[model samples]
Target chain A: DVKVTQSSRYLVKRTGEKVFLECVQDMDHENMFWYRQDPGLGLRLIYFSYDVKMKEKGDIPEGYSVSREKKERFSLILESASTNQTSMYLCASSLGGGPNTGELFFGEGSRLTVL
Target chain B: TQLLEQSPQFLSIQEGENLTVYCNSSSVFSSLQWYRQEPGEGPVLLVTVVTGGEVKKLKRLTFQFGDARKDSSLHITAAQPGDTGLYLCALWAAGNKLTFGGGTRVLVKP
Candidate 1:
């Protein structure tokens, strides 16, 4: 079984604060993603890393950045958090190239509250 | 940008009832997937349908892909209380990206 672990399950931060959310996958998958889920709006991608030191922005990447210093770890950074950034963050990983590449294994989401 | 529109944003039914959730899109997709998410947890992949007009079954759940690959549907038979959750349809687009629908929240009462 693949395991994707998130560093924090819950977080609280003030506005304009810098926030860091870490994710680690044990399956050694090459693809990792960050998404934020909000009511009515659904889940929107924040950023994704295809390999170590490689990252790409997703649909809603504003006010967010990502770091992929290692193959097993991908991090999401909010340079300056705002109340609008408060939501559930999810991390997922998958095998890089194959017919089943779209199958994503996700970690328990981290709920961040920006006050 | 490609978009997936899911119907019946919310459903409430008694146990042993049958229900279907639909996902429609104007843009063509290479493949589509279904996922179920519980509260406080990330979504889990339920099934993936790639071929046009293809159908797959998992227990009492049935998934079908449109012949044009632009839509999909999930049907649950005799839904149980344990089946209550959010059902989401997603598409695998170019650049290895997965776009998700807004999801349908289902509640099954005992």
Candidate 2:
């Protein structure tokens, strides 16, 4: 089975502190994404990477940034964490193109709480 | 930007009941997918409907894609406790980005 692993299952950080959430996929998928899931707003895309060193901003990219230094690893960076940033962060990977490109394989998710 | 909207944000019912969830969008999509997420877990893909006016079934669940490719629906029959979870609908947009809906939280009691 394809596996998407998130480094942390839960995290707590102080306001204004820098935060990093890591994700790795073993399937060698070409597209990786970071999304923040909230109660009523759904899963909003923060950033996505189509290649190892290429990244694109998504719908909600104001408070977050991303890095894809390696094909398998994608990291979400919060320059300065705030209370409003507390939410469930999900990482997903999928085939870059072709017939099955739309099917995403997701990680277990990292729940972060900023105090 | 294309947006997908799901209705009935929350639902509660007893086992053996039937229910249906709707997903609507103003823009046309190449395909639509349905996912279910349990507590503490990531959303799992349930079904994908690509053709206009297409219908597919997975056991007790039935999925339909609108003729215009702008909407979809998921119906569950004899829902069990295991069916309790958040159901999300996503659209496969142009840039290979999947635009997700807000989701419907379903709770089934025995």
Candidate 3:
């Protein structure tokens, strides 16, 4: 079975602390994405990587950054965590092309709480 | 403003009852998809509609795309407790990305 694994299932951090969320996929997909989900806002994309070392900002990339140094690994970074950044983070991987051509497999999600 | 709007933000019904959720967008889309997210899991793709006026059925669920490509609907017949979850509608937007609606939270009681 295909799998997308998120390193942390839950995390608590102090405001202004640096944070890292790691994701790994076993499918060898070419496209990987990071999204933050909130109560009323739904899931907003933070960043997506289409290839190793290649990344693109999504609709809401304000306080977040991503690294994709390897094909199967994608990491989300919060330089200085803030209360507003507290949200459920999801990682997903998809076979090349786009959502129209294939389905996106998502990880279990990492819930981050900032104080 | 949200690119896509979903009606009936929350729904609670007894088992065996029928329910329908609507997703509307002022802007036409080339394709649309529906996803379901459970309590502690990420969203999972359920169905994708490409052609206008397309209808797809998955067991007790039925999905329909508007002929104008600006709307879609998901209907559940004889819903069970397992059907309870957050239902989201998404559209294929420019930049090869997907924009999702706020989502409809459904609760089915037995």
Best by TM-score: 3
Candidate 1: misplaced stretches above 4 Å? Answer: A98-100
Least accurate stretch of 10 residues (summed lDDT) in model 1 chain A?
Answer: A94-103
lDDT of 1 by residue, A5-46 (tens): 999999999999999999999999999999998875667888
Predicted model 1 interface RMSD: 2.0
| Best by the lDDT measure | 3
TM-score of 3: 0.98
TM-score of chain B of each: 0.95, 0.95, 0.99
Candidate 3: C-alpha lDDT:
0.93
Give the poorly placed runs of model 2, Cα more than 4 Å off: A98-100
Q: List the pairs of residues colliding in candidate 2.
A: none
Look at candidate 1 and give me any clashing residue pairs. Answer: none
Q: What docking tier does model 1 reach?
A: medium
- Report the TM-score of candidate 2, chain A only: 0.96
Error (Å) of candidate 3 at residue B40 is: 0.4
- Indicate the DockQ of the complex predicted as candidate 2: 0.59
lDDT (tens digit, per residue) of candidate 3 on B5-101: 9988999999999999999999988889999999999899999999999999999999999999999999999999999999999886777677789
Point out the worst 10-residue segment of candidate 2 chain A by lDDT: A95-104
